[model samples]
Target chain A: MGGRAGLLIAPRILEDVSRGRDIILVTGTNGKTTTSAMLRAGWGGEVAGNDTGANMIQGHVAALCASNASRAVLETDESWMAVVISSLRPRVVVLLNLSRDQLDRANEVRRIALGWRECLAPETYGGVVVANAGDPLVVFAAQEARHVRWVDVPSSWRDDAASCPHCTRAITFGDGGWSCECGFAKPRVFSASVGATLEIGGESFEWGLALPGSFNEVNAALALTALAECGVEVATALTRLRTMTTVQGRYGLRRFGGRTLRLLLAKNPAGTAALLASLDPEDEVWIAINAQLADGRDPSWLYDVDFDNLKGHRVTCLGERRLDLATRLTYAGIDCAVVDEPESLQGEGSVTVVANYTAFREWMGRSTPC
Target chain B: MLRVAVILPDLLGTYGDGGNATVLAARARARGIEVEVVPLAIGAVIAPADLYLLGGGEDGPQRLARDLLVEGGFVERVRDGAHVFAVCAGLQILGTTFSIEGDASYPGLGLVEATTTRARARAVGDMATMVSGHMMVGFENHGGFTSLGTGVEPFGQVLVGRGNDGHVDGYRAGRIWATYAHGPVLAQNPWLADQLLSEVTGESLAPWASVADRLYLERCERVSTRRSAGDRTAGRH
Candidate 1:
């Protein structure tokens, strides 16, 4: 396990799942932890994950070792997917969308994708790939697999992949949800709402995530998909989805000092934007950027956020890389104060802190001292 | 109104590549430039944008994204000097074709005329590169291999961290600058971010001000600063 985080550990733990123990492996850039946790909760299964959100192979192994259950549902890292899948050969694999994450450590997106794709190959003892049908690569790879079952997109989300994986023609999106130009249509529906009514075909139920991002909806759908693949009734899964709790610090609301603070873990371009997109127009913000190796060394992707939604918000910045975060905010025309000191963040209003995963942890550790 | 469009695939584009547009809009507004951002997905109308950004996604997301782009012609339009910046998977999608493993090869946007292959190895952790043009320091964790075609201009030679594709990766076509470094690659290196803006708007930017910023600027001022000033001082002899 060395020094690997829980993200890395979930997969390794799943590798040791005993025979006939249904082990489910879930991996993606984001949503892995959330989807895995949600599925476990929805399925009422004893699950092992980086619910502490460590999300590394070492964390995977540790979580598995710590679990008393025979079945392990893991949130695998794209970096270690192949390595873990080769070792674990889990019963089912659920893959969420891939996005830019830890570029310094992840180098390129394809690198991680290749690792997952190789391990989830069809020839690998008939392993089932429960893939996102909306994503081109996932669907394309599913096409190559022997046992491929696709999960449709939630109603609130948009079909981001718009071309045929075979011919590279534009995929058509209509009331029917998603279809590729090459006649490769998928069963995914693009749904977007603050929350939605999920009809599990047996028992119609409604579940709402406290978070506002459309990405979270996709995460919820991915969770349901994993449950369905596990032979759990859709209604049973949907009914259970309502009783779940949000993972701590992944858009979790907390009371720090006197103000209500929202803690969001953002370490990449897509995640940051998704969090930014979901921000309340009325909330004040405190953005922290970490200089940690895991939080990413570069902060330029901050340039991609649409700060228009945050037209008149008071913003405070923290972290060793505070200037980078501050400057990016400054560049975005948001007036911000750089607090090189972490203690100053206390009593700082109902602030939304969008920081690296480590910065989020440090803030949580400091604000909610054990 | 200055309109910037961010084209994101499912995988790597999630983190905050969209934040780049927000930062640009804020900067443009501070400069009294009107700005608007339009997030474009696969089938959205390909509006002629002033600035185009593609972010990182998983390899499958990149392939799906590349296929989505193959029909849009927007990438070609971006390559025609619409001011394009691509990160991680974004950079991989710009290549002619990217291969995740030996069994599959997905076509790219073909903007930079390069090919990326997912190597049979994982290249993770911090890196110190020696890029050729400007000095940069960023980490690289990738399993892809990027082979730049002829007539391409590299972003820089790796000074201490990994370069374009985490190896000898480089940018090309003079206008477009692609790299594997993330963490909002421009977050710390505002100078390079400015360089990307300059590449698009054809304007020069003011110098960055910070101890690390100044050190990075000084490194940029001296091409061989890493080898000469750092621990390799004697090795430079």
Candidate 2:
């Protein structure tokens, strides 16, 4: 208590997590939504998170408010973590990878890590920090703590933003994760891959999720790692993974009115590339674009995605910014159609509807007609 | 066949909003829809597609993104046809212009011809967004003051939570719909996703998509039931 102070802002959220009830806090620049949802699915603690995909103080608070039990899993935005941790002091906090997020409020990733480190340093012995060892920022933040539980990064760490936390040496990725001549390595290790295995209520499954992407594998692993650290037996955690369900618009699948639709949310270059790369060659697809400030005022990052493989698909660009999305698609030489009303369009082949966080939800909300 | 195009500004990293895109793709595939995701960065080749999506980020990213989208005059071209949808920041970008920090204002895509000014206080909460045109429900979180222009309005009202712009969020200008609620907006409200899909597919809304809606209701009920049960158990404890 000498020269040290701990802050408590959201007391109730942390109180719920500490009572030996299953609890996990997911925070990161990206993948928090999917990762937290996966953590909930993997942990299966009444399953509460920012499923509306809104990660913030109120969103997590609402989840806690709506939570009926002492045990629940929640995802907190990186901005909200310092305050949340101040109060909740969760038993386990899983930090997803960090990237350049909103340029306005918190422009730099270092600021976020610094904030988390400051908050975490005060509570060295309180909660375990389950972080992505592959991410230099996260690893460095963990190093600042007296006690940390670092999770092993998968073999593939894409778009690595590695900078020597000590000597400011640029970290580079080679075979597994990241390395530097400074001897900073992702030291954590684990066996089973998150996406590689599925866990149901009480059974472990060897099947992958319906969605394609290596990121999901990392997300899955993070969830599994967090839950396992929380004391859930790997065998039991494996069962929860098998029966994992898509959180609505995140990766929900459904057949309505004799048509099948796959919904995915793409908001950035990294996520968009992952979305594009995950597309199978055999599937038919339709795309929609929106140009709203909420989607990012620019809509310029589309150039980063490799659209050269966008052959043989009927594309539809819609939204107030449909022209923006359409123009980009057309320039790629992919034939596309413009549908003013996404609901009226009909399809016979495998249909994929891609929208932002909002449009995707809107499209998925329509009543499934008989 | 599935076709997905993302109109990203710059803040795609904030709050994991981009994960919404991946989630939608994964959900659609569960139903056997072949998904093709395309990122329509400004100045890149453009293509018309079935559906359009927008997400929410901070104000600065919105402005930086606004400059990029307007330069290519891409928003105007995309709006002329696509079945479009916009979220918090997306909704703001579609307007004529939006004010950041209540002083510096940037010209939006003008697709909706409205203005969004950052509010003195952010309206962050679990809101009950009434699904008006579409059968949907979701959560909202934002700090922008969105004023619907002469011809624009919101998709729905704040049934039990914060309306579009705090007490004044949510705007609808024809097919262009925008709101402040994120709801993780797709994960909890798949019907909303299908509604947007309907606009793209030119098909009637499917009842099965309501599985998510019904499940949401059932989930609420389950939570309530679980709460009561826990209360009783606690009484014994």
Candidate 3:
């Protein structure tokens, strides 16, 4: 549905559907789907969303057509965010962290960030923007927004954000998060997750999420703040968020070829790092990397991932680019076997499968019992 | 111990180009040669090393890398004796000038007698080439269209995808090698890695059957078979 036909029909459909409904546009490199899911769950109303991860303009049209909800939480791809924002003029746009993802098809991180900065300038975007304060790129892009709600979501991976997007200077990271020597720093976070408690506007809400990792906690905080800006109560949003177990098959336990495995989707280095950080050091893990169109044709970004954290784990590499993963693992001093198939690997208990885009989708398709 | 310095890896080593350094170190270690992989950070003083490597990066970082290298006198050092392996943006920065988008061009280190201008379309796909009678398999993702001078020689001829500017793939002049092929180029071509190591250490390292070699062979077969079956459109970005 990515042809000229879909692009043409999307505008007309969006014009008709978004006439009266409040739209919340969620966009970023990583955590877009999961964060949009959290926002939808905590929206306290019937919300239209692209649950299948179809985040383009066509996807939005299909989603709006599928649901009759007055309020919608749309997950927009970073490259399409500017167009989508101009079309929808969303009530609360959640600008999550921006990082390199699909460099072969997408623009460079700083270029995209610069485009976002131009698109989200105060004169262009009058809506409230919920932005991540810890990521320097996100901070740079969202600072131009007319109204901004900054959330402190400390990033696990900073390689993509090693340099300032504004000045190209090396960014310094400390206990307070990242700051550029060029006078740009993390904004004052209006919403933040301190320990297990989510603090927003001086009010603290305690909740346990089924989604693992501090990244999800950050996602939840950002979503809750966006929901609040959309007039959803913090307590109500928290309750709805607590009920969410998974989004688009992520954090799912599925049986694959007689072995039960927990499926985690990591499309880029930052997401991969977050997924790795969420795992136990000794957990048996299988990484499936594919260089398909959906998974970014170039697997060069794999080198950016700090695989040193997976040193002690029994790791097996699987997928089309399994050899590449194995080669990378070898260089990282991590012992890993390159397996032709996931079933060939000998494991006693439930193994964790961290896969990129296409691989995760393929596994999800295979894991479903007929 | 063989000293290998990866210049400004934090800035220039995007595109998994760090794997080239890793392959060098691992291959050297496998050959009973102790290798020291030194990461020369931005603004660090360039030290004399037997081999120096640089990788690809975005325009901002590439320009920054070129400026730092010029200021630190690393370009002269590389020209003097160091065996250098550069990939994509690294190759561009080593040339006379690199024309980025918006028609803005930045001066390079002038280490290589070539100039890179931003191409009309970026070449992105699986790339194969014949380098020194050896089949080299890798990936190409670059927007620079490079033209070599009369004194410069290409590292290889393009076998599948567009390389350099649809004909040649890389430049090889004396001890320096630069390529747009960056599957960490060395991981997919162990022969080239060994050749570079041999040039640096002045010893012909025996060909050892490594797991990397097995992977390289498999990749070569895959690319060849795929091309034979007329599936040129299968992996192009």
Error of 1 at A340 (Å): 1.2
Ranking by lDDT: 3, 1, 2
Q: Scoring each candidate complex against the real one, what DockQ results? A: 0.28, 0.03, 0.57
The runs of at least 3 residues in candidate 2 whose Cα sits more than 4 Å from the true structure, single-residue gaps closed, are A1-22, A45-50, A102-106, A122-125, A155-169, A181-183, A190-207, A210-212, A255-258, A331-333, A367-370, B1-237
lDDT by residue for model 3 (A72-121), tens? 88998888877777777789889888877888888488888888888899
Q: Report the C-alpha lDDT of model 2 over A1-370, residue by residue, as the tens digit.
A: 1101111443364344345445577888667777776776666556555576556555656665555666667777777777777655577888877765433345446667767777778454367777777777787666666556666545332322434545444466766677767888776544335445543234454645544577777677677767877767766665666565565555666554557777777766566666766777776666666645456533434544556656765566665446445444544556666667766776565566667655665667762422
For model 1 the local lDDT of residue B101 reads 41
Report the lDDT tens digits of candidate 3 across residue range B1-237: 899999888787667788888889988998999999999976578989988899988888888788888889887787688888889998888888898756798888888888988887788888888888899888888888899999799988887777787778889988888888888888888888899899899999978775677778888998999789885543232
Superposed model 3: Cα runs more than 4 Å off: A1-10, A343-348, B229-237
Q: Which candidate number maximizes lDDT?
A: 3
Candidate 3: residue A214 lDDT (0-100): 84
User: What interface RMSD do all candidates show, one decimal each?
Assistant: 5.7, 12.9, 1.7
Quote each prediction's TM-score.
0.68, 0.55, 0.95
- Residue pairs in collision within model 3: none
lDDT of 2 by residue, B45-110 (tens): 556665566776555556655666677666765767665667777878878778774478878887
- Model 3 chain A: lowest-lDDT 10 consecutive positions: A2-11
Give the per-residue lDDT digits (tens) of candidate 1, residues A1-370.
4435543554333444434456788887777777777778877857655566656566666676676776677776677776666776777888777655655566555455545666666666477777776665566555566676666654323333433445545666675356765577765432222236543334444665555577777777767766777788766766676665456655666766776767878776556667777777778887887756767655555554555556687777777667656666566556777776766555645777787877888878766521
Of the two candidates 1 and 2, the one with more favorable lDDT, higher being better, is 1
For all the candidates, what are their Cα RMSDs to the real structure? 7.0, 15.3, 2.4
